[model samples]
Target: MNKVAIITGGGSGIGQATALRLAEEKVNIVVVDVNEKGGNETVELVKKLGVDSIFVKADVSKQEEVKNYVKKAVEKFKKVDYFFNNAGISGSGKFYLDTSLEEIDQIVGINLMGALYGARYVAECMLKSGGGSIVNTASSAGVIGQDSVVTYSATKHGIIGLTKSLVAEYAKDGLRVNAIAPGPTETPMVREFYAANPEMKENATGGIPQKRLGTPEEVAELVTFLLTSKAQYINGEVVRIDGGFTNTK
Candidate 1:
C-alpha cells in the first residue's frame, strides 16, 4: 500500500520541496496551504510524478481548519503515514521593542500555534492508524538566539518544545515526532525577508560555515529521510541542518 503524507505550507519552499521528494517515494500527498495557487500547483506537480495528490486550503493557526485538513486527508487517503508540520511566517525583522503587538500575535499564531494545532490533529489521525512519523519546522533561531527575530525565535523554540513533548507522551504509542532547525534557507519566505533586510542576509551568509544559504531541496532531503522508515528509530530529536550557523553562536 502507498503511504500518505500531509504537508502544511506545501504551497512553497521547504514544504513544497518535501512534497516533491516524498512523491518520488510514491507517497500520496495532502498539500495544505492558504495560497490556493501554490497549493494547487504542488498538487499537480506531485500528480505528474505519478503519486495521488490533493490540495487543502487551510490556515493552520485555526484549530478547526487544521482539523478539517486532517479529516480530509483521511477521507481521501485513508491513513496519514507522515506529516510535515511546516507552516510558519518569519516576522518583519525588527527588534522586539520595534515589533508591533499585532505582528507578535500574527507570528505566534501561524508559527507556534499553527504547529501546535497540526501536531494535535495529525498525531491523532496517525495514532489511530497504529503510528506515523512527523517532521516539524524549527529554525536556527529556535535552537539559539538571534537578534531581530525575537518573536519568530520564540515560536520556533516553542516548536522544539512541541516536538519533544509529543514524543514523550506518545512515542510508545507509535508516534515519531521530530523537528528540523534550518539556517538561512533560500525559501521564498526567507528570500522575501532577506530582500527587505539585505544587510542581514550578508551577515547571515558570512556567519554560516558553508558561507552560503541552504537550499529547500537540501532541507527536503533531510525531512524525507527523517519521515521515512529509514528513521524509524529516531524520535524526539531536533536535527539541525544549519551548516554550523548556530554552532558559531
Candidate 2:
C-alpha cells in the first residue's frame, strides 16, 4: 500500500514543494489550502507525477474546516501516513507596539489555532491506524527572536511547543511529531513579507552566514526525510534548517 499525506498550505511555497517531493515517492496527496487555484494547481502537479491526489479548500483557522479536511483525507485515502501542518500567515511587518489587535488575532487564529486543530484531528486518525508522522512549519523567529513579527513569532513558538508536547504524549502510541524552523526561506509568503518590508530582507540575507534566503525545495528535502520511516528514531525535535542564520545570534 502506498503512503498518504495531507499538506495544509499545500497550495504554495514549502507545502507545495513538499507535496511534489513526496508525490515523487508515490505517496497519495491531499492538498489543503484556502486558495482554490493554487490548491488545484498542486493537485495537477501531483497527478502529472503519476500519483493520486486531491485538493481540499479550507480555512484552517476554523475547527470545522480543519476537521473536514481530515475527514476528507480519510474518506478518500483511508489513512494519513504524514501531515504537513504548514498553513500560516506572516502578519503585517509592524513593530510589536504598533501591531494591531486584529492582526494578532488573525495570526493566532490561523497559525496557532489552525495547527492545533489539524493535529488534534489528524493525530486521532493516525492513532487509530497505529502510527504517522507530522511536520509543523516553524520559523527562525520561532526559535530565537526578531525585532518585528511578534505575533508571528508567538505562533511559531507555539508550534514548536505543540510538536514536542505531542510527541511527549503520543510517542509510545506510534506518533512522531517534529517541526522545521527555516530562516527566511524563499517562498511566496516570504516574498510578500519582504515586499512589504524590503529593508528587513537585506538585513535578513546579510545576517545569514550563507548570505541568501533558503529555498522551498531545500526545506522540502528536510521535511520529506522527517515524515518518512527513515526518521523513525527522530521525534519531538525541532530541526533548524536556517543556513547558520540562528547560529550567530
Candidate 3:
C-alpha cells in the first residue's frame, strides 16, 4: 500500500536511511528532526526518489512539539500510516550511580519520553485513519546490561517495555508495535562513542561474532521489515540486530 510515514530523527543515522528506503517503496515521507539542515536535506533526497516528503523540526520529547509534528503531518498528508520514533540523545555517559538527576532526566526525557510522545500523537491519527505500524529504536544496551552510559541503557530498556505494552493495547486496532535493538552500529553517535573510548571501541566490535560494527542501513532494513507486511505476525517483540554480541563470550 502507498502510505504516509513520519520518521523522527530523519536528519541522520538509521532514521535517515529508513526514510530513504521507505520513499523508494513509494511511501510518502514526513521527516521530523531538530536539525533543520539535515532534515531538509533528507526531504530533498526523498523527493529525488520520486516521493513526496516534508521536514518538520521538533524536539520529540516535548508534548507540544510532537503534537505539532503530527498535526502538521496530518494537515499535509491527511493520514499517517507508519511512525518511527527514532530520535534520541545520549546522556552524560557515566555509571548509573554517578549519573546526576539532571542527566537521568535528559536520558529519560529524550530517549524514552520522545518515543512515547511520538507514539501518542501518531497512534491517535492511525486509529482515526486506519491502523498502522510503530517502530521504536532500542539498542543492544536495552537487551543486555551495560556499565558505561548506564542511564542510556536504562532508558532503552524502558523503550522495550513501552513497545510491548503498546503492542498489546493496540493490536486489536491493527496497530503493530515493535522495536529494533541495534548493536554497535556505525552511526555518528556510535562513532563518537567509539572515538572517546578506544578500548571500548575494540571491545564492542571484537566481542561481536561478526568482528565489526553494523551499519545504519542494516538497522534501517530491519525497521522497514517490521513496518511492512513481512513482519505482520511480529508484534510486541524486540528484534536484535547485534551480530551475536549478546551471545558471544
Clashes of each: 0, 0, 0
TM-score of each: 0.99, 0.99, 0.96
The sequence of per-residue lDDT tens digits that candidate 3 reaches over residues 1-249 is 479999999999898999999987899999999999999999999999999999999988788999999999999988998888899876645667887998888778889898888888899889986699999999888988977878889889999999999978889999999998898888877787667776787877879998888998989898998998888889999999999998763
Number of backbone clashes in candidate 2: 0
Candidate 1, superposed: residue stretches over 4 Å from native: none
lDDT of 2 by residue, 1-249 (tens): 899999999999999999999999999999999999999999999999999999999999999999999999999999999999999999889999999999999999999999999999999999998989999999889999888999999999999999999988999999999999999999999999999999999999999999999999999999999999989999999999999999999
Q: For residue 177, give model 3's deviation from the true position in Å.
A: 0.5
* lDDT for each candidate structure: 0.95, 0.96, 0.89
Error of 2 at 197 (Å): 0.8
lDDT of 2 at 163: 97
Clashing pairs for predicted structure model 2, backbone only = none
Q: Compute the lDDT for candidate 2.
A: 0.96
Q: Number of clashes in model 1?
A: 0
Indicate the residue-level lDDT of 45 in model 3: 97
Candidates' RMSD to native: 0.6, 0.5, 1.3
Per-residue alpha-carbon lDDT of candidate 1 for residues 1-249, written as tens digits (9 for 90 to 100): 999999999999999999999999999999999999999999999999999999999998889999999999999988999999999999899999999999999999999999999998888888987989999999999999899999999999999999999998999999999999999999999999998999999999999999999999999999999999999999999999988998888
